[model samples]
Target: MLENKVALVTGAGRGIGREMALMMAAHGAKVVVNDPGVSLEGKDETDGPANEVVRDIKAAGGDAVADYGSVSDSASAKAMVTRAMDTFGKIDVVVNNAGILRDVIFHKMTDEDWDSVIKVHLYGSYYVSRAAAEHFRKQESGTFVHMTSTSGLVGNPGQANYSAAKMGIIGLSKSLALDMAKFNVRSNCISPFAWSRMIGSIPNTPDQEERLKSLRMLTPDKIAPVAVFLASDDSKEVNGQIFAVRGNEVFLMSQPRPLRSVHRSEGWTPETLRDHMLPTLKPSFIPLHMSRDVFSWTPV
Candidate 1:
């Protein structure tokens, strides 16, 4: 589907990112696999993972190259794009799958926890997309498939930083879609439910552990097909959409929409809002719950 194209996939060292890199290459996209090889918490980095993925692609008779650069830095991100263009002539697709986890309940969350997650997930996404958008603007064509999370779309305890960053990705993709639509540049995000190292390493209760065994059926490979579709012309008209992929099921998530409104002849006072608007809007409000709670079905 992506023959004659070149793609750069950040966080391609392991998990979903690694699978995405391989899938794109299999589909005939020369891939630039970028991975700093950082641990789950973004420490103890190495180059082995990225090199191994590149080797695997080559062994599979696919085309790929290793890029040992962290996506968190704007300069490094620009260099990643340059490598793709330099190696394969031009970049047609970019997958922002790089991320880190710093999970902690809000009150107990340290500054380091919050900052690290935002840096990698939010700022890193921006750096890559910003670099790609510039090149895409010049070429007048490009596609971006960014990674989001159900934790962000719904809610997840102990993931304030991650949830916030992931949600930011959705907004970023949406606005980018609107801004670059005229240029034929496309952007979309996927909120994936997959069993990856990040999830495996996080502490879980007995129930979560049991649930995760089921969730494992929705492996990273299952999510890669969605990324491929988004990257290819198959999704040419599918910009700014958020897709939730769980096992064999794919869901189109609804964006925020107004449900109810209360207007007065004059401006609304706090008391008036409390008495009138609250009652009118209460029925329309969706209850806040953890993402897993909202989608508690067994993985199919």
Candidate 2:
């Protein structure tokens, strides 16, 4: 479906990013597999994953090349997009999947932890998307798939930094969607819950691992098809939206809820809030929960 398209997938060296890169290539995209090849904590590495993915794609009769650039840096991000353009003539799709984890409670979170996570997930997306948007604007047709996480939606304990960065992508994607629509460019965010190295390494016992696997609703491979759909022309009308993708499941995320309140003519007091407003507040009112469902191939 992506025939003749050139795609740049950040962090495509391993996990979901790697799978997405391979899938895009199999679908006829000339892919630029960009990855710093770091560990789950965003440290340590080898270029093996990115190189292996490229080799696998080539063996499968698909075209792809490896890029060992850190998407967190503006210069490197620009070079990644340029590599796609130089190698394949033009870039048609960008999957901003590069990220790092700095899981910690708010009170315990360090400045370094907060900065690093934001740098890779939020600023990294900004750097690469900004560069790609320029090329897409000129072409008047392009696709951007931002990698968000369920932590950003439901909020996981001890992941304040991670959640903040992930949720920021949603806002960024929505604003970009509105801005890029005039050029026929589409931008969307996906909050994925899948088993990957990051999840696997999360300190679990053998029994715990088995139990968690059974309960998992998504796998890395399942997430790729949605990415492919978003990157293809099929999703032309699907812009300014966020989706939660899991195994055979796809659902739209709801917007933030606005608070409704009653105003008093005179100055409010603590007693008034306790006696009147407290009772008036609806405890049964459920906050918006994003939709989740199994998805099949259909036009946007």
Candidate 2 lDDT, 135-254, residue by residue in tens: 999989999999987777766667788888988998899888999999999999887767777766554447555456543545688789989999999888899888887666688988
Model 1: how far residue 60 lies from native, Å: 1.5
lDDT of 1 by residue, 20-113 (tens): 9999999999999999888999996799999999999999999898998888888999999999989999999989999999888899999999
Question: lDDT (CA) for every model shown?
Answer: 0.91, 0.85
State the displacement of the C-alpha of residue 75, model 1, in Å, after optimal TM-score superposition. 1.2
In terms of TM-score, the best-performing candidate is 1
Q: Stretches of candidate 1 above 4 Å error?
A: none
- Poorly placed runs, candidate 2 (over 4 Å): 203-211, 215-217, 259-274, 284-300
Among these predictions, the greatest lDDT belongs to 1
